[model samples]
Target: MEQTTKNLVLASIGNIYEQSKSSSLNAGFFESADADLKLVSEYFGVTPNQALIVAMVFALNYKGDTVDIKDLTEFFECNPLKMLEYSDDFETLFNLGIFKKIKSTHRMKLSLANDQFIINQKITEAILLNRAMPVVEKERINDIIELIEELYKLGKQVDDKEMESFELFRHVSSMLDTNAHFPLVKKINEFEFTTTDTYLLLYLIWRTVNGNEATEVGRIAQGIFSSSSARINFVQDIINGDNRLISENLMEVVEAEFFDDTEVKLTANALTLIHEHGIKLFGKKKKSKDLIEPESITVKNLIFNEFEQKQLDFLYSTLSDENFIATQERLEKKGLPKGITVLLHGLPGTGKTETVFQLAKTTGRSILKVDISRSKSMWFGESEKIIKRIFTNYTEYTKNCDRTPILLFNEADAIISKRRDAGTSNTSQTENAMQNIILEELENFKGIFIATTNLSKNLDTAFERRFLFKIEFNKPSLAIKSQIWHDKLPILLQEECDQLASRYDFSGGQIDNIVRKAEIHEIIHGIGVNFDNLLEFCNTELLAKKHESNLGFSKK
Candidate 1:
């Protein structure tokens, strides 16, 4: 937020806008705003015009056509068309159909297509801080309605126009009063905040509600900052310089810019700070999905070889506070990344995934399993955003979590694959970008991260070096396989288990699967656990693997 940095960003944004305006004027009609919008929209997914319009709506308190283009231009130091963009802006928003247009009954001298706009009903509910409401039973709903009615009657009379807004506010107030509010908000509101700080924070919360990580600092200033002429300067003062209201060290917020074209997510620490102050002009934080519970695998009962067991024992010891906390200080002193990143790579069905689960269970850490396929997208540039968002979410999660959870990227080969050859399509570019983000995040990570991949050969060289520990999970040894068989199907004699384990080159997972099939066969057919049936199931499993091209095929 330095003066030089602020001026540079403003200049860059203004240059893009000037080009957009020039193009519009040359054609003698309002044309594509892509050039300007692209610059700002690159950060947020919305078009530049759309971002500007949304900010304006919030600034003008959702006034329809009553919003003044001249005032907006003077306030943000932009052209009138950039402020309004006339009918093109409204039409585009309408086409997106997230907003409803209210026809202006009164004629205006400014231009054509006189209409006002407000967002959808659901959006209004969300904006009003009612979207995070917990579900109640039918009987409780009736009681709540009756209570609201009683409260309404007791309240002072208001005009019909203001009545609806007042009632909604009162209802939200009643709900917060009756129920236990969000713990974070309760704790956050204890700190005092300036009015401008409260508004900016509300805007940040609004963006998150709409699934955006953060809004562009420049656009945010144009939309929300006070002062008509030097609005951008005010934003700089609020964030940077001496007497700044929001700073990284003091508020744990940031206004980051990604030089070298690396993606950056800048959150103004708006939500956290806003939550501290109980200003309700903007909507409350939307309730996120409940954190998925980690699988409860009994680590004590898990089987492993001498080397594997030793590695796991060492892992558990290091993860424990007695060693880890002490060593972390030393690592920081040495200027090395303090995160413990482990790569568990090897053959399919080799217990790589299970090992991660057991490690979490043993260490009393929760596992956030990342499915690589889910993070990918067919759209251009979207995959990279998804990867960046994942890391950002993880950073936030670690900040608030009591014990940092292990981020397990399962079947990670899909993402950590060898960087695509240069000059390929956007898909290849996105894949490389994804790897870049992962690599950078790994370098800076301060929590535990574990990645499992069957195809280690496909992994990028850069990623290999980032992992603190690289453990290969090869197929279980004969003795270990025999132990697995006896453990899973205890009915089998040791001799029989040894014969099966010795004859078949199967992983622990394959052995477990075969045992499960044998158990199901016995249950369905009342055929007591037969060796022939178990062997037959093992043969089918092997054949299925061959059919899937997982095993080597013979060319006759």
Candidate 2:
């Protein structure tokens, strides 16, 4: 908390007090102070003035006196000019309450009474503290302090007072300590506890406990903490804080909830935890089934034309072949190759990413998309580390599941583009290192890898030969586009689909976008599908494509 925050807190309290009086209701001074303190402590550290101002405002407003700048200045033993200098600090407080600015009168006065102020204070305090019990469990406070300590250990610099406050709260109460120390343990005992609370406690434990060993706890915590509602019911049963939750129960739960069969015996929870913490109680279990399977990526609603389907089928078959495996084995016997790069060159919006995704889906692999632009670094060797990390993750996943994960290098032209004289040495070096790492990883890789680039000619010839396959994804033919439009759009729009498809040389992705835009337009304007709206949408996409082409050319 800075002086500015303190002034704001005080101003907020004062405004709340005045508002309470006008409505003949009580304001929450304690609650307001606690909230202000928590926010300020979290963001700007602890400032005594902020704390002091809060205390003063509470005290003055509690006495039913109209809070003015002069009164606040006197209470703080500060000059009026000093208060005026920091007047802007109170604007947030003023907005939160119903404090009106008397621009014509030039005076600030409270329109409410004292009793209302006290009531408001009590309510606010109750809401802020979350309960009336002042003495929180000592262990809870310790746990919070310990959590802060862990964050500090991880190089997070937090305010000393913030840590101290949590410590103090924990010291005063037993239940709080019990709740904080072993959140998962105690949360299990709470009869009314929900999965959200269970996950939250797990998160708290992970945040508090810092170590490589604690990663399993973190992953288990994260699995239970996602926004996806579907996961809750699935992960519900084996969550008890008993021995059953650890071994047999977890295995059973995994089979029953996550996977259809027991052959793999690995649940999403188990996989997530194992990946993070590295198999804690159990010895590393070999994956019987592919962890990164094609079916894992939901594509049931995705519509594609025959041409797009053929391209996807070709890529999928190439990756899935026994020949590829034999080749990798032969390479390994001879000693691993430097890199195995597969390039998917095509026009923009021609399903490069979708094809990559489809391959990942079919091959049972996770696609770690490489953002080449962001990966480029000015600092020597830094970009290499980022690239290495991506490959390292892929390697680890492959090793864990006994299947190599797919690495999707999107926008590869940015990295693999032919060297230009204008680019900095740093840029060239970074690109070379990225290419080198790709080469190194692929040479020994038993898994599938794909890179999508719009500009095939921009890539180095040496790099091109490293790829096991180079697939060219061409724009959909007019007939293919017509079929895509007919299949994707509503049944009522069938007659118009052929005319629309003939009008624009759209790719599969572009056709999808056109339909999506039409749907949005229908929803917004409350109109049926019309030629004018469809044409406008097509024109919009064409303009966007032109703009991107111009930008790409300009960059070159």
Candidate 3:
């Protein structure tokens, strides 16, 4: 067997046995330990002597104290394998001891009165074994040693504070590559790494390592800062890389390439780069960055018609109320309460979702948009767990910050619609279960909750009444549509833009598509505002929408 594999098996056995001894008084403890050991023995199929060696080592070293191998053999009454014959078996264990070794000395002597033989520490024995290995094996041994140490650290019992530290460690470890290549020392400006920035960076590091969504990054920052000034300061630091807040040790592991001899301080550009690339450096598989948050979005850029704007203004004003503020404060001071919900009903292509974003942005709050369609499941009770996880994540995030995060339920009517005629089949049961779960979640939710649905009539009246604000978003007027087109299109396309805007009966999304296509046309054809390209793009969009409408009709 590979030395590392052997050591791992031994360690597992040791841990199980130690756990057994610790809870020996308990009736099930020994039985549980015996079962675990039997499992380990079955897994490794090692000799009895090897099993005993492993068990003895684990028991003695559980507290990270030293143990002499010779003494270990005597204690367990197991014959010691010849150093040369069982070299591979002992290699991994020996190397771990070497890395953990603090001090060692060679001494062969008998106890003065007791006639006991003195020996070196377990760590010393491991080191001696490591040194005896070939040069190639020595490197492999070193790697195993480091791996063991890391696993040991990860398994250590941690308090809340220590947990935070461990999280920081993981974050730093993950960002080592990014930090090394784009070392914060070179990238961050001298003035930026203040106390507030340090805390924010620490929080960012934690979030980064824990695989939290990027949209939650700002919310995490807001939670860490106790005061407005601190929050502002953190934002400033994020907008400017001020100092080396990440650890140097972590930077080394990733072999990060540093800018040579260049005292390049963090500029706005550096901050932008960190925001864009730092997430990638964490080594997670790239997921779609489609999750939308409120503060991160800009309404000025979106195509909001007059009626949509009016509804947005009302919602924004409601969110800005002192009552809302007091409610939020109360939630933070005590804990989250139940029965806070908002319903935004609108037709397709209206600004229900956009308004939700605007409300969150205006209030300087985070938004977690839960897609109800995606939450549906085939298995009984599985959908409930998925829905619960979403709420749990939102709650945990808010609790961490002591701020209420806006929970956005998109297409909520589909999930929480009024019940059909009484039916007890699995599908009906699932639907009923989902509705109950959502209602329960809504009742318990203390923070801002916004539900957007196209078919408002389909929603349960009980659910509808829970919303503090029930707003309807209607289709935009021609005047508002003209403004949306003008705002959405680029400034360089001037007179031609007005003419193009006037022609199309386009929604906000269609207008956005037109602008994107126009940009591409301008870039490829070298024509700044070609009428032909604009018309072509518009026709394509109109045709696509028509095709979708026809498909929906056909399906119906």
Candidate 4:
């Protein structure tokens, strides 16, 4: 006759639990059972004692009750201290996923006895069907985020001293090796960071995507390192930039000058890497007036000179969604930054900002406009954080859009100009710090960035190297200005448009000012002013003269 699970349990845990007051469940008792220790141990591929504990938990789960080592004292009628002997086997079973660990309401400072265990539901079903349990079991990692989060939990255990650093690191390497199917896992494995460094990187990745806002240096050290000296050394390594995560551009320690505080976070490189796996780090997207949708932008006809037009024509073709993605992929393959950074540097009224608007409109993308004024804060270090966040938020916003948007720094002279000498003054230092971070972010930037700056002369050389397309917005040529005038005021005769364009070397933007004044005139007087009135509007548009009163007339 075949031995069923019911008979098996009867021969094992049930026999012991029923009418048996054995103070000691020793080798003699197990050997005397109908299904003895040796028979069960070899069958289950566990030690004799593990077989006994498994049978006990199986029977407990069948009854909808939990089992713990603490409960062993009463169940087996053995001494409570003797019950402690099963902890190693219990944990092994829990780790194997054969037994599920459940939270117990034990008081603090209690030992492993406080950990209650339940048989894995699947394992119990298999047992009921007379099927054998697998020798080893673990949760399968479905994606990079799950793998990172699992390692992160093990890292916290290292802090509790529940596990050693090397063991935690071992699990890190093992988890990565086992889950190398993930894109992020494959990328990280391509590099040879030490196991400890890999774990640290994973911890930061976990924090960033998990939205755990507290990344203070001290707090991180306390959570990741077990001993005081190790914590201090880890903190020092971060501060000194000696840590692999810092040196390799996977993580960063943001410093606050006013309060002398520090917080750690995943760097742009790390953010980009994780994003390649399609995980958008939460809470990084900023919702403010700064984001301009393409649909919201007014269609403006821009007139540039021959040279500027050529540059813009090439840029427009390269930034079309298909061309942009193909180029970025090729650049990434070559280990070059996959960013299409454009520096539109020229005079203030040269249509730099308007060009960005047109580019975004033509490319079918949004514009994350950087408001230069609000980007800086009176409080120290806040500006730098805001700058870093701009990049982070842009990274998140990429996932929210069908095509990545443009990060426009209109009138960016304030941010991209020649950085001041370090430590010159608080404001100067702040400026220098902001520029340095921008340069760094530009290093691995992965999207379209267009900075329109009027400071043609003082723009930093470092910034020059970072920008791929440095197109100058020279003031509109005489012919282009004439065309702009003809387009803006079709009411003007061609000769009159030429005369207006030739007399004043106005840019498209300056021409726009005159067009607005002409609009006001028509609004009040209900008729187009003569050519003299057009010149008058142009003249006062640049001067401080009270130009709105003449109402409909440009000038007499």
Candidate 5:
């Protein structure tokens, strides 16, 4: 141990002992004896004396009380340098709200704001656990220990002793990773959950850990292979049990409303259960109502012609970060709408729906699939209510989501079709009501909305005006057909593929169907997918379409 460092440590401790006894030192006398202090301060930056001064302030007073620096020096029985030399540390602590001061009244004075017990406990840890402290400072560890003991005694008198103890050991043991995994977590793990209840519990936890998207009741019903009504009954059964899995008693569900149509997230208890037992729930988490799950297809999976591909590239670029930021910063400054609304119109199986999925996957957004059939209601005004609910859910969803999701209205012929003149019939009124709600929602819409339809001719002009980009997906060109044929059947000769492409005028979807049939036949017959088998499959597909009867008269 260096003689000078030892003297500085002992001297600092002596000063604190005098302060505890409410005595004062000769300030001018210690000012002349500051040589060794400078050497120690140069090495340590802030000495134990300074830490003790701050600790004593915290220990002796309540938060927000005015404390004077001059008073602190007098109370500590030391020259002002003992407290002033490390004023920077105190200033930093003050800024961090460990201590605070009034700007107008006595600016040099400060008051403690942070808990004294916690600070002392951390200081105790620094002395006990840290191996890097100089050996010369080892004898002075008793001073820090005495301060911690005093703080602990004071803390236990006013607060929960067990909780304070828990905080101290929990810091040392690293027991709680998050507040979600703390004191009450063991209560959930103690339950003996039933097999069915356990599956539901783990499934919710797994979704939260891996997928941040919202999970709806319909999706949870589908996941458990039960009807929605039956799923509700199952949940009720669990909540009614002695060891309730989804009850307020366990805090697994904060509200009863969460188990219904609302999107659900895992409660803190569920998270704790997964960590404690290490259970893995294997199912896709339902995306938030606005967000559709990410599509499995990438842009590379999209097989469009040169013109269509370029159009898609433009759409993708429009969704890029640079353009979005520019729109928010520049165009939005001029009061223009900040969102993009696109309409994809073409024949079925022409990749309109798949394109939406691929576009969402490429641009990193979720898709919200709007089912027109599901939205329809037999009751007079119920259909309009459903449509409005869709928009309301979407608005609520965006508030919680990280990225804006694509709202997909696939095969939207019913909604986008021309509105019939209003008559006294209930059906006509319901249709008009739904269209009105949709129009209003679109006008006010601020997020990405995409609608695809086979019959764009029937689309109302008013609805068409709302779309910023309307892309017409036509049948594949001859060259594209050849590419599709070759790509689907790599074993086929180029000449045969060219001949097929020339003879057939098929959409990508029809070609995909034909190829699938041919591949199946080849597997069953133990033969290569030859030209003859391909033609047979193609004829069968065309025949199926021909035999189908018209379910409704062609729209006027």
Candidate 6:
């Protein structure tokens, strides 16, 4: 804003702009413009050559066209080949965030001619206002999760090829070095890790915090090591547990069958160390494949008969965020269990699971769906441990989340079925053990838990007492079914929908199948949907609708 600063900047730009028309910017060219070069360097804190490059870029057409070295031939009075020599300076300025990299031609290495650049707007503003370079200090991050989030963002930049891999390592290392207010830094400093080990540890922590357990190890090693042989050797060391990251108990491998598919994550000890520093970055993610986000649930405009709808309305009210929190608080005051275990029992395809999803969606909660097959293992005692971990993980999710998620055991016939005598067989013992773990978890559970089962009649007596809400999903009435058909496929006429509803004893799931089939028919055959097409699709929908069984042998 000062006149003196404006005069100095104008003088420097005039000097550089005049020199740019030279026949050539020879070896001693910057030396000749000593006063201008020195002033530019002092203002921007860049090298003389970098300052000259920036000044030249600033003097370009104000429209701010993305210019490559080839495009500067006319202004510099030099050939495109000659301008290529300044690629390193251009690249350096671009990396410093003074120049914006507009795009890349290909994934492979490209010439300076192929690369495009434009002056970063902030840099242009500062220069135009005749102000010194802006020094934006990185905020001192005291939270461990915040630090990991920052690293994760930068790591993504590297993954997207927006940044150099080495820059990510340098930026993170420098950030922690400068902002040493947090205990994480102190703990990391205590490790006394070498640069490579430090980078590996940080990368694993970021990946773990981001719930990216399957990040390729080679891609990370490639980022840490420039030399091809060194990268390969270090990756081998990582996979073989020879690297300091693995040997020091800072990281562990994510089990994968192939070497190329190998990945790594923070070890339990490493997670504990992170926790000791006042923030826990690693917890069970509530938004994953098995854990469904409420928005993604497709059970919209769900229709149920009067009795079922009333039961569902009550359940939804109880699970509503504000209501649930208030109920939990009052229950806690009375020294009662704050958990609400819900039993959604009904016939298959009768909207039991769909109702659960709808409840979660309406209540703005996530569903941590249980995979029963995976819960049971062939190995003795592992089944119980798996069940315990599922509950344990859910507990962590509830603590970290704003609204506690619903732990949904969809189609949970195996879980709700009566347990056999433990003395009969090892399988019986395992079943009893899993049931016992569930009973105990329910006793201590402090969040929303819902399990949908078709075989409610076989319910274990103990779990029956634990359920606070039991909502049965019976087959829809004819009127409700007709409404559901019209709602699901708005293209269907009310009379047609009513006729179809009157004809077939279909559940909501079966109707969904028909809608999907009609869509597919229209797409594949370019046929306009008709009632006959709907009827045909409906007729074929039942391949003798059999009850889904959860009986399968363990993989060898």
- Candidate 1 lDDT: 0.59
For candidate 1, the 10 contiguous residues with the lowest summed lDDT are 154-163
Candidate 4 lDDT by residue in tens digits, 379-460: 7787898898888878767866788889988888877888887767888888888988999999989888989888869988
* Reference-based lDDT, residue 5, model 1: 34
Taken over the whole model, the C-alpha lDDT of each candidate is 0.59, 0.51, 0.52, 0.76, 0.58, 0.76
Evaluate model 6: give its lDDT.
0.76
> Candidate 4 lDDT (Cα, whole model)?
0.76
Off by over 4 Å in 4: 1-5, 19-22, 26-43, 95-97, 107-111, 126-136, 142-144, 153-198, 207-244, 247-249, 257-261, 268-298, 303-350, 363-409, 414-451, 455-556
Report the error of model 6 at residue 19, Å. Answer: 44
C-alpha positional error of residue 172 in candidate 5 after TM-score superposition, expressed in Å:
37
lDDT of 2 by residue, 185-208 (tens): 343445333434333333333432
TM for every model, in the order presented, reads 0.53, 0.45, 0.48, 0.62, 0.48, 0.56
Task: Tell me the deviation in Å of residue 100 in model 3.
Answer: 8.1
lDDT score of residue 228 within candidate 3: 56
Pairs in steric clash, model 4: 521-552, 533-555
* Ten residues in sequence with the least summed lDDT for candidate 6: 105-114
Tell me the alpha-carbon RMSD of every candidate: 21.0, 21.0, 21.7, 8.4, 17.7, 10.7
Write model 1 residue lDDT over 1-556, tens digit each, in one string. Answer: 2334333334444554444333423332224434444544442245656655543443344444444444345555555565455456655555454455443445343343244565444543433442331222212323322332333332222211222322333333444344325443344334444434433443455455455554555554444322344445654454444322344322222323332111112343543443344422124222333233344456535677888778878887888766777777789999988899998889998888888777777666767667777677765666776776677667655655556778888888867878987588777777788888899889899988999989998888888889988887778888998998889888889998999999899988888789788778879998777777788888887886568754577566
Clashing pairs for model 5 are 214-288, 292-367
Question: By TM-score, how accurate is candidate 2?
Answer: 0.45
Residue pairs that clash (backbone atoms under 3 angstroms), model 1: 188-276, 189-276
